[model samples]
Target: MADMPDRTGPVDPPGPLARLLHEALTRLPADRASAGLLLAVSGGPDSLALLLAAAELRAAGRLAQVHVATVDHALRPESAAEAIEVACISNALGLSHTVLKWRRDGPLAGNLPAEARAARYALLAREARRVGAGALLTAHHLDDQTETHLLAKARGAAGAAGAALAAMRPWRDLEPGLVLVRPFLSVRKAALVEAVRGQGIAAVDDPSNRDLRFARARLRAELSCQPDQAQLLQALDDAQAQRACEDAALAERIERLTRVGHLSISPLGEFELGRSEPVDVSILSRAVTAVGGGAYPSPRGALESLVHRVRNESDGTATLGGAQVTWSKTSLHLRREYGRNGPPDLVWPAGASQACFDARFDVEAGAEPIARLVPYGRWGRGPLGHRTLPIGVNEAGAIVAAHPALRWKQGETPPALAVCSRVGWRLCADLAIEARSVLTGRPQNAANRGEPVGKGVADTYIRGQVEAACVARREVARAHFQDG
Candidate 1:
């Protein structure tokens, strides 16, 4: 445990900055008031200001316990010392602090900036989970958002441009439970610097921010000389509003036509073809990605070709994003390509809490080791009477434990297996919620009325699998006792 700071007296007042932070905090989900927050501080001016504002909120009882963490990417020689300095500042504010390190060895895959950003988020997420914090806060502000939009425009990155225009949301789910929050999206960088200076906190400036080799740094330099700052900001705001409307409309169309499960199926006929090509292509891309379990959607060129075939041709087969797409006269069918090499075997060690096999099924173990999990393809057969790709723990080709035991006898018990439908479930749920929002004229995030949509199904399925595993373990114990 890190050393706890003294909670003696009130610190310096944050003045107007405190008010701004409170307003942003109020916009978060209602449940956030109870769920604690984790601040990702880099000892920079922006993050230091965020920490101070959050501390004020904590003092006023507007927020629950607040914790701070600094990541040492280990890329710079002075990063370790800088992390220690952040700890001291956190201590001054009477907040618990943690130092997380990036332990990746060897050179990165050439994209240093992108890799570093990903690594930073991964570290922050792990720390958020460790501290049981529901929300992770960063200090990204309006200037950063503007820079992002301009950079995307310069590079002709339409997708990145749209994302930058949308800017950072008040809250986004980083994972299943952890939400990332950026309260300073509307605040200016100079305002944050002033706030940190008012608190007598000195921040370290990372030299990388000004490096001309990076696109963002070059954009930042150009912005200093650009006279149309207000116009640029206004354009960004308008773009964000338009993007929101487009997203809601697209989500509605997707919900109407797509069904996500073991197979992401959608019916395409005159009704779908009647819509704009962009909408049709977007929905199909999401479907293919969901079914294929790919990290990203297929390229636009491939998706456009597939869309054209689906509209014109009667029957055909195509592969995109590791998914086999087969279309008939009326509908398109997408499923994982089992012929392609699946994920490697998973070792379910004894007493392991849970294991995932091939990223498809959730595997729970019994009291003993149960069995070493292998792909069903190795045995040249499906498990539990289902043709879907099933996983089985085998001993020399004899099946012992199988997930989704669809064909188990009435008197026989088998190790539990449940479809890991998180990806598919989220896809469907997001579309459904967005569609409802568009229909009801409500905000997309507000459509669920406070509760997370689709969480219940995923949670219920996993809980049922865990409970079944417990019963199996108990049954095995009872049988052993009877034999003894």
Candidate 2:
């Protein structure tokens, strides 16, 4: 049996949960694993358990610096108090704590949970960057994964998609530098409850978990009634295995295409397919989302329809997921479609040196303070034509320069701008990096430059592979515990 650390002056050896956390942390890239971590503790049992385990590890010199952040969404009257309680606990444990408040400027109408979640992550990301943390930790457990699978299924996920939704990745990039890590996804909620009890802390039991007002809560209620936990997990395992197979095959295809020069992405963020090249739906979906500036890939049915049109039509243009798709006998082109509204102009704060524009590029305003960043198209045309990218305009509306991605003959030197691909790089990060390197003549270093690293667009496949491996290991561990 693993030794549990005492809460007194002298600490004992780290416990089993701490060991699990160590394992998870070690799985990250060495630099990130050793760097400081920001723990998102909500005072809930799972998060509290994570905090306790991490604190023990830190005290034993098994972990690096740890910071705690409790987000007060201000949805309930008790939320602020709960955040304070978490802060007090963190202080007693000898860790720095920050309470980030989510201030809602307007009334949010649809999907309150989803909205809150987005806000929470944004706040956490801001805090993490400010504190120089490499990664943020969230205590999502096995029960959460099961609930997610059930929710996805209820939303009409089926076939390969259903398989892909079976589980969550242990670690994923929240942005270029900051990663969101779930160390306890494989741990059961019951184990976490026990761990918290062992720590002699009273964890918050959020009424929302049993409120039944939310979809996940309602699903949790149903699952708890006749909890055939083993059967559900077994089904998830099966799905995860299927997802791994799909991802491997997809990765192979992407590698082959890149090797053969059939696939390439330009510095202007255009995804191009060579003439006579076969159209892979998965690859096309990623290109469309990346170029279209959409958060997710285009819907499957609509994407398939677009593919059919691309194959049949000799030369035509179509819009899907905010990206314009133009096909010709020679090649197919996909780029961001700026309609009547065009891209939103970025108003640079007086003293700020950096700002993300269109969620697509990281812009650095040099010595000259940028008054406003307008679409390059607004000032007629640059090297890439009108609206190809953004440009800096002064108060008098004179074009100062183009985006770092483009060249301007009449304008001064552009500010430093680097592409942050709108399309997620989880699936084909390597390919995306290579394509960017080949097209832009830049070194292939995604880590330092804030560029994404991964396969590219085979997210479903890669996610499946990662989740399956994680699930398999946890299952083996569970069986071992039972046998012992």
Candidate 3:
């Protein structure tokens, strides 16, 4: 027999995992050519495979800096040890690694798993920020997607059409400046395990994965006995595609109907509302959430009721998602309900880079710590009305600067403040810059406009005016600091 092909001389060129990862990275919305990525590793086969694939990409100069982090929830006695082992393996691969621990010194409450997952992401996000990574990568694969779909279906959240079975997306914005990417959503667990083994990496098996007490584990066991696995996965894919198309259309309609500012002003009469309740509800829900500055949209049942009330009542105000919704003959208006959802007082110390007052304004302070942000509504009616959602920084309990055009104390200037209806406009600005860069086919640093992307020409024009005022305030702050 011909001397069996020299077993493993140089190993095979980038495997399936590496190729898939390269393709996924190329599709990321943001510019990753010079950016770093933080991988949330669990020392499991899936994460180990991701690390191995990422290492390959880095070595080939197809990727940038790669960092690894293992979050130890500390629920299990073996978890700490597993994290240490993961760190060791990561370091051996010539990657920087950190182990984040979730410290729990009190009794657990409802949904321990859900709480732990939230803490895990928060820790991951903090670490990603500290390391200057633009995105966080997770090892959620095809098996996890199937498990999620089955779980959603069982929970009655999947709807009659099984729309919830669409599963997780490849990318999501976890927060501003931090994106969560799941590159292996389409890859299988078996493939991941094989990839890890190919790299000579030993992965740890968590007992929790097999514990029948967990819903996912129970579902996995149930799925193992099913013979229509391929068919189920294909159906899920089709459902996901249909859901994507519907969501895209809804977003486009919202973009046209909704306006972002102190209020999510919309002209409902312009659209044919009688036959499009679902679309109308979606638009109103998004607008309420955007204007209310809430972390999440209102519950579906409550939102549908609100839509019915808005459409039926010709002239009245109702509260939904902490926003006051008012409708008249031709238009609908939604604004923050100050009594129910007003922002807390913010302390802006001297020399602070930036501070957000409510989710509506981005306030930047100069080198001096001499301002406190107070709600404009708190000061009663002044030259600027309460409708502005104005925020003014006070020095020694006296108003110095109020946003949407107001500056007191002629000689004493205040810190710079940029107003936006929601913090999401910053994300939009980043995307806009990224799109421009992609369209121009040039590597360009994202521009920092420090202003909101308003919904219409009027809103845009007002933002421009506020931005100019902020620039003047910055100059005043600089000059004041210099004189002192």
Candidate 4:
């Protein structure tokens, strides 16, 4: 906590900027909106403006609850002090604020900005969960979106050009329960600065914004002199619309495959794809991320090469992003790669009832304390039924817990302990979100004036599809476990 400033009532008016905030907040479900919101205030002009506008909305009775969090990356000498400044400002507005510090282990290697960004999100997400907030809001404005679009083109990923052009989504699932929303993507940075200044608040300016060493900073410098900002924005809007259609097409195919049993995702994070038609490379890339436990999909070139081999009917195994793909005569299997770079053996700490391992499986502990959870390969892969599923063993190396599908009758797991695959949940949840996005015709650029066609019908159809997929998933899970 920090000292509060002298102020009262609403920090600012519910003007156009505040209306933008209200519109973004409305995108969330009523239940989640009621749950509260965690704002990622970095003390910069954009975030500071966001904080002020949200405070106004809260005072105006338009917002239920709002919380503020700042990430102290500790990258610069003044980072800690800047976080305190944010806290002081938040307190003046009569809002709760938190400062999350990024703990580094040893030296950081490879892509410092990207690593810092990831760490910031992880810390913010943990804090959001602790505070019972369902949505994490960031102050990414139109200028930021433009910069992202330019950077995507600079990356030269031609194979994924369509996706790259889409830039960033307006709203996306950060994790299972938490949703990340950027309400200012349609707003301009200058308007935010003016709003903050109107409140008589001085925002913390980081020199890194103009540091030419970073590509974004350099792009920003160049764009300041460019005359065609609107043109770039229009390009981004066009690309986003195209990408939305492409995603809808992909979701449609995925639904068809799951409905017909040509594609099934086991609760143990294994993907079984029966060879009937040519498999989409995008689907394989998605599977690689889901089963391999990678934070993102594999690179397009790698995925394209793998897809080529699979299409040519190669009868062998290929590894990408710590996932192993085996092609058989009639089907293809994707599982976590064993030897190296795979999930390490983990112990279920005493007193903790639940845990997540390898970013894939969610585990629940029973009353009986287990020794360690190791890959099935270490405990004689044959008996547990599936080669990909992990098992918990006692001190004597006897299987005490395993996924319901992989349990062996010889040493059946107790009723209390359970292992559920996040991969299954993640895939189904993603499909539902995509289906809704496509059906509702939600554009990435929220400021677009285009009207959504058949929104009600689209919503109903997508909801039904989602329910059907879940039902089909349950049936497949039951059959797979029983057969195993």
Candidate 5:
């Protein structure tokens, strides 16, 4: 919450700079600045301005506390000296600064700019992890995103580059929880240079920016001379719009023919389908997002390939976006595709209000059951929402549905769970939350007075096996009576 200075001060909001910066800040993941962050400061205009602004923000005490650092690629003999000068300037600004240096070479050596940039990030990530920083913020402004849009458009269709450089993302925001923000992604580089100079700041230039060997640098030069910012921004919007339109159409079709729930998919093929008629990839991705709980699974190409395989071949499945899906005539079977490892081990506090999982179940005890704790196989990737179960406690905390269960009322609060544990962690980590009830003491629906409560292998497997057999025998009896 950085407060604006007195109205007499030259700085103001609602201006282009504030407009862009405001948008970028809000778009940042979690939007919380740390005690200090590691900033990727190049001596160039974009990064230099970013650092100065970050310093001002720190002084304002609104954004996260930050320290500045520059990575000297050392491609040029002057790189180290320039980085040193930059650090000195940063120090005078009352910001702690450091310069990291690394050497690059070989076949990959020729592409050292990109390679070194990546190496520098690895160093930063390791440092952030060790130091426990919330994130590393870099400045990639509007002009950069526009330039990228042009380059990607020239190379392929609308989705060629992916979602318009999210307002921030020179660094990945997904992993390390490092929020790569480009608050200036929409700000003009000229304005940035002006911001730097407005406070009398010196800037550095990268000679490689003029190199023709790189395609982006070349397009950047060509675009730098373009005065039509409105036209360019409009074109990108249109490109994005076109992409969304196409994806939406395809996604809609997929959604209609498909059923999607959190952690499950029915008729998954429609989502990955190529354009047969009016195919929308956008809607399909939306469905994927809904089920994934914000986890990005496979990319566009992988999704398309999976859909193709399911249709062209028999008995085939493909793994995408961390889920395995198989096609069947009856329905598409989708599940959390786990390997030897899965989601990082996480702790779920009891009474958690909102919980997401593979399959969620509940139990209660009453004359007319309020909720049913059923097996995962019984429900196809969904819960019988707004329902309740019967009250009959088992050995491993599982309450059985006493009277033709699977239906519960609102009064059945303070529910318990019936989970499959012998199967291992697969069913355990999935948990309970923010759940409340009227029950104060554990009720006894036990077979014997001293019997231990909560369900165990005996109730889940052994007793379940017998119950299944009884169900089977009833079907047989009905068949015999009909034949007779």
Candidate 6:
């Protein structure tokens, strides 16, 4: 990759990224409440190019609004230093910026790569909310998409073309608050690298990227060396287009098969004589999720398996989805899987009546909203107490769910019961601990509730407590449900 030919243009770097970005944003999501966008800039080739291009667009009046963000994983001793450098570069470029620091030592996400990605979006979304941004953009180029497609293919993803990963997604699945715009998906890695070089810039290389044990680094290297890789990339584009068609058809079918107020029906003997089409199982699952007022949250394999199970399910039963899923004669029930005890009943601190689960929702006491917040997503109320919700398609900036909402918060701590109050005060009281827990998933005892832990401990304590709450919420997890 270091030896790849340099192809850079000051105006438009030659590749699909430019095309994708220009094409995708022609019409951003139709949110009247959308705030300025937040761009993810790593000082790396991909993101640096993104920042530069975005600034240029804004200057030329192409992009009306946007900002910049660089996340410091801080995995290495020098990570912070590198981030500071990135901040310096961004400032020189006259872009608004912020650095999200990540801890090296933490309870490992099942896959380190997956965890890191999650942490990045979580951090990015968090910052976006703070700045009143509606969406968080990324610099994932065509090459990244190609690699993603291949990886998905390697994992046997059938419905969608495996390597068409660079497709512009409306939002991140985990963080639906922000739209994840990947304008450079069409551009090659060589192009971005060259763009950075042409600018006389140096990009940071994470040591983890060099470790071949990871699939991404390996695929990247392999694709870079393959003959006629250009043609292969073209094929992926075509496949992605095909998948788009199938997904559209499936979306329509699923919409028809499903209706609000009715549980999903498992039609048996429906496939016996081919009298009726199976309706792509993948689409069916996604449709079912939509009925719940939720987007797809199942992992690739889990979702695939669930689709299969539901389609081929007999009179018997099965289970699947984000939490606990049970298949019965009645319907396929998808819910969150909890730790020890199941859901604890409603117990908002002493002040509240019925509680609101999703941060996107608001609770009004009198003429004004008692609770007006969206963590990593968006937050800001109008003068009339009307909210111009800064909404994107996925989860991005999320602060924290109310702790009293946590079944565990009901015990005896003095300040632990402050669930439905102001967001700023509760967050300051627990951020250090939460940031720590973001790295390491350590357990925090409830006996010492309301007390903050060391810098690196919040990831665990908060996550555990939150996870408990998520599951408990599942007992009553009605997706997209809101109160008047």
Best-first order by lDDT? 2, 4, 3, 1, 6, 5
Pick the winner on lDDT between candidates 1 and 5: 1
lDDT of 2 by residue, 83-197 (tens): 9999888888888999998877798889998899998997887787666676788999888989998787777775546565666667766765567788787777888888787
lDDT of each: 0.59, 0.69, 0.60, 0.68, 0.44, 0.45
Q: Each model's TM-score, in the order given? A: 0.71, 0.83, 0.70, 0.77, 0.53, 0.57
Q: How do the residues 52-137 of candidate 3 rate in per-residue lDDT, one tens digit apiece?
A: 77777666655666799999998889999999988877776678999998877588898878899988987887787667676688
lDDT of 1 by residue, 266-338 (tens): 2110012222223277767766675565666677789898889888887788878766777767556665666
Q: In model 2, where do residues sit more than 4 Å from their true spots?
A: 1-13, 29-34, 275-277, 312-315, 345-354, 365-374, 379-388, 392-402, 405-465, 477-484
Ordered from best to worst TM-score, the candidate numbers read 2, 4, 1, 3, 6, 5
Q: Indicate whether candidate 4 or candidate 5 has the larger TM-score.
A: 4
RMSD of each: 14.3, 5.4, 13.9, 11.1, 21.9, 17.3
Q: Which ten residues in a row have the lowest lDDT in candidate 3?
A: 448-457
How many residue pairs clash per model?
0, 11, 3, 0, 37, 43
**Model 1 vs. true fold: TM:** 0.71
Worst 10 residues of 4 by lDDT: 446-455
Best by TM-score: 2
Model 5: weakest 10-residue lDDT segment is: 431-440
> What is the alpha-carbon lDDT for the whole of candidate 2?
0.69
Which ranges in model 5 have alpha carbons more than 4 Å from their true place?
A: 1-23, 29-35, 103-110, 158-174, 240-302, 308-315, 318-484
